[model samples]
Target: MGDKAAGGIPHYYLYGDQEADVELDLLHIEPIRERSGPNDWRIRPHAHPDHMQVLLVKSGGGGIRMEDRQLPIPAPGILVVPAGVVHQIDFDPGTDGFAVTAALGCLRTASAGDPRLATAAGRPAVYPLAGTGLDIPAVIDTFHWLHREFIWSAPGRRTAILAQYMRILVVVLRLSIAHQDAGTATPDRDYDLLVRYRALLEEHFRSQRSLGFFAGELAVTPARLNAACKARSGKTASELLYERIVIEAKRYLVYTESTVAQVAHLTGFDDPAYFNRFFTQRVGISPGAFRKQAARSEG
Candidate 1:
């Protein structure tokens, strides 16, 4: 393992089976830390442009930090972090766990072979893996095999490792579905909402801002949907919906040279004044000022 200091943090690039310094090429797996102390494990916020990771915590507890949200560590569970999601993990300082990371292409190939596996593209994918004891052993076996292949780092090892990774993905999907059927798993309301709502908002946030529009499509009353959202997240359904809209506005303001009126129209606002007030209320800055600041920072 090679120790490289990246931005004041020590990265112990440890590989038990392969030569160290082999940059993360498409897919990789490694043990972050073994059982050590109550607060022994720590990782600063990080983002991977083209990599996704799956974390399996066999024991101990901690928390996972995702974009603007924090999820309590569900020990003995599995976690998936898709690409482009800013995240970090803090385990019971002495916690023991292992994580596997693979490129998006690798995930697709794995999913292509098995209809049971689910593929989440361009979004943070987090799933709990502890409910089905039936599939647990198989998942573990596949996980270890991938890790070993990574460590062995022999010629043409990636092809074999990728195959094993796909097999585990299939087992995990089946186990999750079976657990849901048996009512042993907690309702994945937030995840289900995130996937479905995000897609709807992408298509309709411009023409519709009413919560009722989305609630109706989900076959739940607005109040019911609001409660489910509030239970999973502190935010109400409307608040979450508006948050997504505001986020889009910010992105346009920072990345485009569009005028305020152009931006307002693009984000579904009929009036520039209304859009300005909305943006300022949520972001604490006027759209024009925000754009200028971002430009200056980039420059």
Candidate 2:
């Protein structure tokens, strides 16, 4: 019943699936080959809302399609990918480097003083070292040390890992300042609330909870919740939930051999007739038709 398994983006866990270490804040470091080699060197479009990824490219060439921008990943390039940026990475075959994924908001959470570190690290900056004679091997050396620290845990192991991270960030910050390759770094006041709301919405979207219910859970008024959502994502709170439901419905239609009624029931619609109308209005096709179309396309 599925064709290309429609509905939503495919989640690519840069960090291997496992129980993350709490002391390290889920920090993970691996060779880029280990992460992307099996996938034919193509990373699909996805966002890490709860993770920051740093790609250190030593050889080969590729590019990253970040939202509307396509930036080249030169040999000896360093890319700092902040949280919540939808990006797809395509690497030339035989690309060499390391991929580091670390804690959520670790880049932005600063300890007093001038918080420009947050601004510098928060932006999705790219530094191509092919043409520019930037002789900063310290960054590369630190990544290696960080990978070793991640592999073995001894006394001050966590401290060493974070120290390496600091060194890498220091280098990244200097490069960012020199090149001023600061990508769109939007600082939204309600973004934190929106992130919290999105987490809660994922848990209760199937229940079709009202805006007031979400507001109650988040300790905010319904209006404030909707306003925050609108300000951050340009979608109201209810719209986000509706989009999630539609995505789930599409997944069922494409992946499962379920009838339209079953799909509707699973998506929280008790009445099949109303569900048909809701799906049709939003997706411009009936559940049965979508499944059939997907089949045709896949065939």
Evaluate all candidate structures by whole-model CA lDDT and list the values in order.
0.63, 0.71
> For residue 87, what is the lDDT in candidate 1?
63
Per-model TM-score, in order, reads 0.49, 0.58
Clash number for candidate 1: 12
- For each of the candidates, give the backbone clash count: 12, 1
Q: Which 10-residue window of candidate 2 scores lowest in summed lDDT?
A: 1-10
Error of 1 at 219 (Å): 1.1
Candidate 1: residue 295 Cα off by (Å)? 1.7
* Model 1 lDDT per residue over 92-157, tens place: 765556777775446655776564464532334344566555566666677788888888958778
Model 2, range 230-288, lDDT digits (tens) per residue? 65444578877887687778878877999999999999999999989988887788878
For model 2, the stretches where C-alpha displacement exceeds 4 angstroms are: 1-7, 11-24, 108-114, 130-135, 181-299
Q: Candidate 2: global Cα-lDDT?
A: 0.71
